[model samples]
Target: MRALTVTVRDASTGPVVEIAGDLDYETAPRLRQAVEGLALEPGTLLVLDLARLELCDSSGITAFIVARNRAIAAQAEVALTAVPAHTARVLRVVGLDQIFNLYPDADSAALPSAVQPPPTANNR
Candidate 1:
């Protein structure tokens, strides 16, 4: 099986994680670590640019969910950009597509400048 590689970059919106190769059981932890290490500030939007993503399994999907939760816990927003058709289909089937904001590309996701408001006590 091909090894999965995750490349992370900073963008104006927030941190942009660029995923490549296959995301599976062996590499899902790496993806999780990369995401967990991010210093997500309140009101920032983290974008996962998946244009280079090659493959994903159940573990990969779980990792994505974990990332989303992390962002929420940080009082930040998370978005997915450039999702491949296969990955998109999987996310949609699992109802995760509704959980994340989807963008056509990194630029589109970055164009938005509105800052997310801090989490209210009730929301937390």
Candidate 2:
């Protein structure tokens, strides 16, 4: 089985966690532990970069939920970036896509400057 590795770094939005490798039964707890250890703040976004995440099972999904709950408890937000197509499909099918904010990449997720401003009446 592929191993799972989670690395956390600070970002403009908040703390960005880059997750690689498999997120299965064996590795889900590791991710949960890592996220539980974070000190999230109000209004900050906890961005999870899943660009290289190999696989995610039920346990992994649970871990994601745990992370979200922890962030919410801290009054922070949560987002998922660079989600693989298969993973996206699973999230969509399970209705999790609606629950989590998704981004094209970590940069787009963490940088508010990259966000598109709402179009004005002139543009509409």
Candidate 3:
């Protein structure tokens, strides 16, 4: 199985975590440790980007729930971005799709609105 890697960075709204590789029993703790270290502010949006995530086992699903709880305890919001179709299907089947806000990409998740504002007439 591929090893998991989580890269953390700041976005316009809050912190963005890019998760790559497999998230199984062996590597799930790494994600939990990384997330637990984040200093999330109240109302901040914590985006977890899984664009490159190769796999997510039961432990990984549990880790996601833990992350959601952590965000809630901090009074912060959480979103999952670029979830793989297979992963999304699993979450849907388990009804987690309703628990998490999902976006097509990190950029979309970081936006104040799903779409950008229109330019003013002055632009002409």
Candidate 4:
């Protein structure tokens, strides 16, 4: 199994966590920990750059869910970028495709308008 590597970098939108290698049961916690350490402000977009991600198993998907929940709790948003085809297939099968925003790349996902805040009642 490929060892997991999680790296975090800051962008104008928020933190971008680039995950590489295998994201399996053993290495899933590394992702969760990396996400937990991020400072997500309201409206901040947490982009998970998966371009280098070699593999993702069920536990990895669960870690993604955990990250999403944390982002929501902070009133922030989450996006997945460059998802591998196999992993994307599994995510779609589980209906998570409807939950997390999917982006083609980190640059696109980090754009200022990538994730807009929901319209408030006053905006209606």
Identify the runs in model 1 with alpha carbons over 4 angstroms from their true place: 113-124
For each of the candidates, the C-alpha root-mean-square deviation to the true structure, in angstroms, is 5.2, 4.8, 7.1, 4.6
Q: Each model's C-alpha lDDT?
A: 0.82, 0.83, 0.85, 0.88
For model 2, how does the per-residue alpha-carbon lDDT over 97-119 read when each residue is reduced to its tens digit? 87787888878766674333212
Cand. 1 TM to true fold: 0.88
What would the TM-scores of all predictions be?
A: 0.88, 0.89, 0.90, 0.91
lDDT ranking, best first: 4, 3, 2, 1
Q: Give the winner by lDDT: 3 or 4.
A: 4
Q: In model 3, what lDDT does residue 61 have?
A: 90
Report the error of model 3 at residue 37, Å. 0.2
- Candidate 3 lDDT for residue 5: 92
Candidate 4 lDDT by residue in tens digits, 37-72? 999999899999999999899999999999999999
Model 4 quality (TM-score): 0.91
Indicate the worst ten consecutive residues by lDDT in candidate 4.
115-124
Q: Which residue ranges in model 3 land beyond 4 Å of their true spot?
A: 114-124
The Cα error of candidate 3 at residue 97, in Å, is 0.1
